[model samples]
Target: MPSSKPAFFFSSTQSVDNRLGDVFSFIWGSYAGLRELWWQVRGFNTQFPDLHISEIENKFLAGLPMPGGIDFKKLFVKTDWAEHEKDFSRWILFDVCTLYEGWAEKVCKDLFSSSTYERNAKAIQFPSGVRANRQVSGYPVAVNEANTSASTLMKDEFLPTLKKSYLNCWSFIDQHLLAYRFFKECRNSFIHSEGVVTQDIIDKHTELATIQAVKPSPFRNNFILPSQTLGQSIELNLKDCINFATIVRKLICTFDAALSVAMASEAILEQRIRNLVSNNPKWNNLPSDPAKREQRVHRMLAASRIPEPQNFANMMAWMQSKGII
Candidate 1:
């Protein structure tokens, strides 16, 4: 007896030009919608008892007469339905964490794809005319593909090579990873075991409980109810989900800025090289043969020590001093 109507209703039209921005907007919209829905449900229940239609409907539905001096009122009001609230919070938190992980994977792919860094790999040659061949891949493919946890991805793939300026950003993400893992476990338990709290789950929660303070400063604030026993379960509230969404937005912004900087720097370096080849009389006067032209450019670039353009500004300055630009 399945109903044709959907259990939930949501609609959005994302901008095609900015996928990452669209993701952030979607996350923000979802959080706001959840909050609005929660308040609406709370207010509806609060007003239900005052409405005469509710009592009439109840009597008609139950097929019972309204007895003398009987108070026909709902037992629960003010959003105090504990089980429903708990389930709602858990669902929201789980969705936010899952989306955050997907966003991180996209960032990894955008930053470390083969097309982005394959040419940057250093080539090594041996005396016997042998060269080493190493395959380049995106961060997700190059790192542990089996591990899908965002926390693990940060630790294994990003933290090791992140710049000092970006350490604060990494810390912001790290602070939430434990809570995200715990939420993931809770989601699994609910899905597989009807929300039964097992000993193993409790132990795992206990192990992850004390990595950091429950409150993530002013930036992100998520709660993990301390569970010390087998029967107890972790709890995430609406505020926790909202805070997590905020942190995720911050991570996306910071990572996008860093990637943009790297890309601009790369573009600047390439432009400098092109300018050098085009403007320098020596390189410009070289034979029009493609191979010879390439060889001359290579020799000129090598002599100017510009093989790997690490610092774009410094490289440009050096090239100008060497009359290569």
Candidate 2:
């Protein structure tokens, strides 16, 4: 019941390792694009004559030719140029508008729709597929659909499961969300406008300084620094987003582990009671007094080797009766 399966940190470690590569590329690519864009956007009138389109694009392009053949699909999922800046012309501003508000909406949608992420996709269900009739095209269509699907996924699958896990890890959730929101706001400001992003802004908006003030966790909390900020110009990069995405995936896995363990523990308890009922045959009508039943369970658990919590017996019984175990 305590999970014979190994800790998810193995998967987490591998995921983080792969994610770091994406994040690193994203950061470098984003910064290159941001630097180029800044000169064009802010220096358009003054430097337009000197700016070369190919040079600017090439500077940030990272020499990774437009993905083709077998690598296209994988590359798209790992990092998208449209979402990143090189494909600005292809980006649907309206769809970007939705993600600028919240990461959960987009992240959840990707989880559900991507066949490649089958484990996550299977978690979401379509309720009658009523919206299936709608037909749309273009980047806007895809983005809008993704948003809708993500919202449904969050409501039907993520929210209920996450809430249950959150009960066990509320403090972590709160701090993470705070940091996420800060990143979102700061990211939007720099990406959307020519405004300068300063270290202070990143610190205050990201709450990195505030978080640093608090005691650190056993795990290294790698502080995220915005790549776009300069003394006078803001540079946009994709690394931060990828890193944040990596963090979200880790959180989901962590929650899944906890949920599985909790379910397994209850299952073990339920089986124990059922075995008792079948073996003794008199367990069904043994006692009607709730107080006495609780006391019996308390004493039995106390005598056992495992140090269970006070309400564990009641929880186990409830799960058994509901067949949830």
Candidate 3:
């Protein structure tokens, strides 16, 4: 007699649970680090008023050439503190973008892997000559590493396919994908150009330039070249970085909630299937062949016409109506 339990069920559920914890933990830790950096910047400003006053007065009165020959007298005088704030902002923006991209990749991989497991466990056949035909030993390589962009993942993968009930949980993050992209571009500019404000960088980020306070005003003043306009550079300030960090935190919360919903839904379905099999003596004495037993269970579940529940409440109601509770 076969057990009739799906072999992949337990492992798949556990994998999702563990990965969700890891993702949230990483996001929270990153947010904490960003806060610490913010405080450190404030501390530096408070402790070093003399540096700003002395440097600004000397550079102005002595007519010393400031960096890039930008006149200190015309610009706001706190050049040293402003430079520190700009550099810190760039650092935070780059790292936060990296964290976000990494999380997106991880979640996508987890979902695809789970879907693949379910299909294989049910022995669901795929069309011939399709990408599914590239399976290695009965498992398709569904982990998409090539196109990990947030827009692509949300539009093409996450939003459309996630259970309807979980969509609302992800809505806020989905709506802010453009903001994420802007940060990504900033990270790229810093890494590739060594923070140079080139015409190409300006053109690439023009859409985000209209955004007031994208960079800290004082920091922005320091970077504005005589030949360059305000929107022509890739400079950012500490305040801008802090605001972006808050956005990232919100995204993390939304994603965490969605994953929780998904996990609960999976658990409910698993329990329903188990109860169905356990309550039937026929299922208990399934065919000796494991493949045939699995097919029997799959057929029975499909015939029940009980669609997969989207959340715990839906699952409870369905189970109650079917006298499964």
Candidate 4:
């Protein structure tokens, strides 16, 4: 039976079980809850069907009393949103990690799989420290050549592949991953060093990012640019991340379809073999053939769909040709 494991694969190093759990927790616990709060206070509206922009300023400012009497957290809870106060403040960070996990999973499955791309991603087999160090930390780890692991390749080449392969499987790669990377960096500072990341940091960097993304191109419409401000910047980044996830999911669906076709073909081949035996007169003369009976008894696979790894190579090549490899 074809294995149903690939669709569920998120990351190669991390167990699929762990990665999926994290995604569900982040989306439902943090993103969804905060979105609900945004909806109640300010009102939810969207120009683009899938794009939702909450009345954030109105919702936040409406509850504020200029004087000292009102507790912000207390007022937040009175509206039944108190439960998500912590998440509201930290949703950006949670999304950052969640999107990162999603992208990491696709990369592992698309680029590192032994069955696809025919690349060796496992640890190198050098016997000496000199060779080991060089091999392990080898530049262009893309393993475009046999006996190499592509994981160590420089970002320019690897990232393009990562993006393209992900695109083939998804509608778009959300720029949110880049934002999440920065968010994770900021989160680490707060968590590990007690460093402050203020609006200034986001504004300056976000403006620069806007320029880069806005550079003229035939495909310019594919990119979305946001204004420069800490909240706006972070929001834009988050959008990118969400878009990227959508792309990855799409690719998985494509691969699933291919697997179904392969399984159907296998069934057809099996049926043909049976027809050949029934029509031929040579074996009709002999007693009920044990070999034929054994062949007929071959197990029919369960009527379930699963990912077949054989398509990985074709997927990799297609992605690489599109500059996503």
Candidate 5:
């Protein structure tokens, strides 16, 4: 099986995390199921040597539900199982790439929407110390070379939006950001180049990484595709997918732990809530009394979504802790 032990990946950001989990589960579930079928068919044949393999396969597939838009018969014939398993692994990594980028983009948009922050994030000046790739401090990002990644999203969109002092809190669990992007480069090749290893992906390999922290991933070497394999179709096997998925999950967990703590603090969350309440004129017609107005605001906030901070325990906890409605 291509699966490791089940992982429970979540940020305090339930909305985004849940979506990520759902996508991860669906792709992984299908990958394991394909391999599981491969083994089960052989095991069943061992028990009943006289029976035809075709009969056993038909019986097994008949028991499984056939969803719309899928041609299971043509897709999963006797000879197709090996290729099918390989295909699932390829897609699993591809899907993982999409999930990581989507979640990062969503969080980036949410965190930067506060009215108190500069409207033009590019205008904000981040300190040199923050950008410098120091020992275990921060990894250098290659936004120009790569298509999309956690490092790219943070460097290009999210980090610029935050105040300069808060940069210390923004640490990555993954030290080798370029090594991580190599997997994403494979993902892009699959997407735009139709699974063929392109010149672009080969060029980015091994050399594209700018920051190699003192403690980089042991799998850092895995990011480099052999130069000989260029121009050929990507040979994404089960092990490759296992590595890709593990790294993506680790990054998400690390990001969630750090950002959730920052979000819980008064300096960030309070300003976010203030921005939300102050900017929009939607609550102009509240009750005249102070107590009634406070009650109404909490009620309204509960019903509507909290856009900033990206994740939270609840609105009430934040309201009581921060002394804001």
Candidate 6:
């Protein structure tokens, strides 16, 4: 059954939004502290003058409890400071990219969790082109659709669905979407290909130009650039890590705010569609197919001496708004 009451896009993201801000604040603040530690280790010789950082730490730090009686010195001494520098940047890239992908997955889940989206998804006739891979053994068709859609978000051309559903908010951040996709490509390359931009990723990087172009550092004069040479690994510093991490963090929060504001209006608009379908005799007179229904609806609007909306969703919302439903 279709959702009876007007409910969608989450009943309230207020708690989620507030806590998200706090969480990111803690994360980036701690990241700053970690960053300082990185610098302190790098300049250890200059500050200590006599003792190496590994020497001081290894002598006294060994007294701490160890689950496996592991030597703490090995971690610092296994690789020189210069080697540690490269590893730090690569680790940060992997860590933040993982965070971004995880958060986006959660967002996808949340967006399609509503009863409205569930009913709408079920209505989709499967064995059709819209990613209907779920087996119908146990779960309902709608459940399968919703699951497939959420899981596939941002991996395929899933952003367009979000843009249509959350039109105004998505349109506002149009350029941000491009940038987000660009970073996602970088993340894929690093994670799947050992930090070397692959041949497939090269065409995408060339098209997006995000990795190809040099980015300015927020905290220093030094720049972050990914080497475009296809087979070689690129250099990534702390500044490079900071740039992507901060942008992804901001983009998520900004998108949440946008969703919160526009959801109620969109909910009302969606409800209007349900109302027209269930309550109106004119709707029953039309064929069950959407194209035929829309053509009939367009004609009805013209015959009523009213203007037709550009899309079926808009048409239904328009009719309700005009007191014609």
TM values, all candidates: 0.41, 0.31, 0.38, 0.35, 0.51, 0.44
Residues 18-62, model 1: lDDT tens digits: 443555576557656645655554466456656664654453336
Give each model's whole-structure lDDT.
0.44, 0.40, 0.44, 0.37, 0.48, 0.46
127-237 per-residue lDDT for model 6 (tens digits):
112346653421134333444434221212222332343213233243333444445566677767776767755654464454334454121222344556678775555
Measured by TM-score, how close is model 5 to the native structure? 0.51
Total backbone clashes of model 2?
3
Residue lDDT tens for model 5, 1-325: 1122112112233454466568768877876786677667666767877876567666677666766544433554344565775677777776777676665554434443454123212111111124244521222121111112223222332333331322122353333344456667778777788888877666546443333323553343343243426789876666657666666655554344333222222244455456766776665566878677656665444333322222223444556566554
Candidate 5 residue spans exceeding 4 A from truth = 1-28, 39-58, 63-65, 68-82, 113-175, 208-228, 253-268, 271-325
Candidate 3 per-residue C-alpha lDDT over 1-325 given as tens digits, one digit per residue, 9 for 90 to 100: 2233221122333344345446547655765664554455445546666576445445334664545554433333334546645656766676666665555455434443555444432221111123455644211122121122223222332333333432222433332333444555567767886655655545434534434234442121222212323345566666666666555544444443334223333443456566666777565565667567555544555433233222434434444465543
lDDT of 1: 0.44
Clashing pairs in 1: none
Regions of model 2 farther than 4 Å from truth: 1-169, 194-203, 217-219, 224-232, 235-243, 253-325
What is the clash tally of candidate 3? 0
Predicted structure 6, TM vs. truth:
0.44
Instruction: Write the residue-wise lDDT of candidate 4 on 249-282 in tens digits.
Output: 4433322222222223233323433454466544
RMSD of 2: 16.5
**Model 2: how far is 128 from its true place, Å?**
34
Off by over 4 Å in 4: 1-89, 95-139, 142-183, 189-241, 244-325
Clashing pairs in 5: none
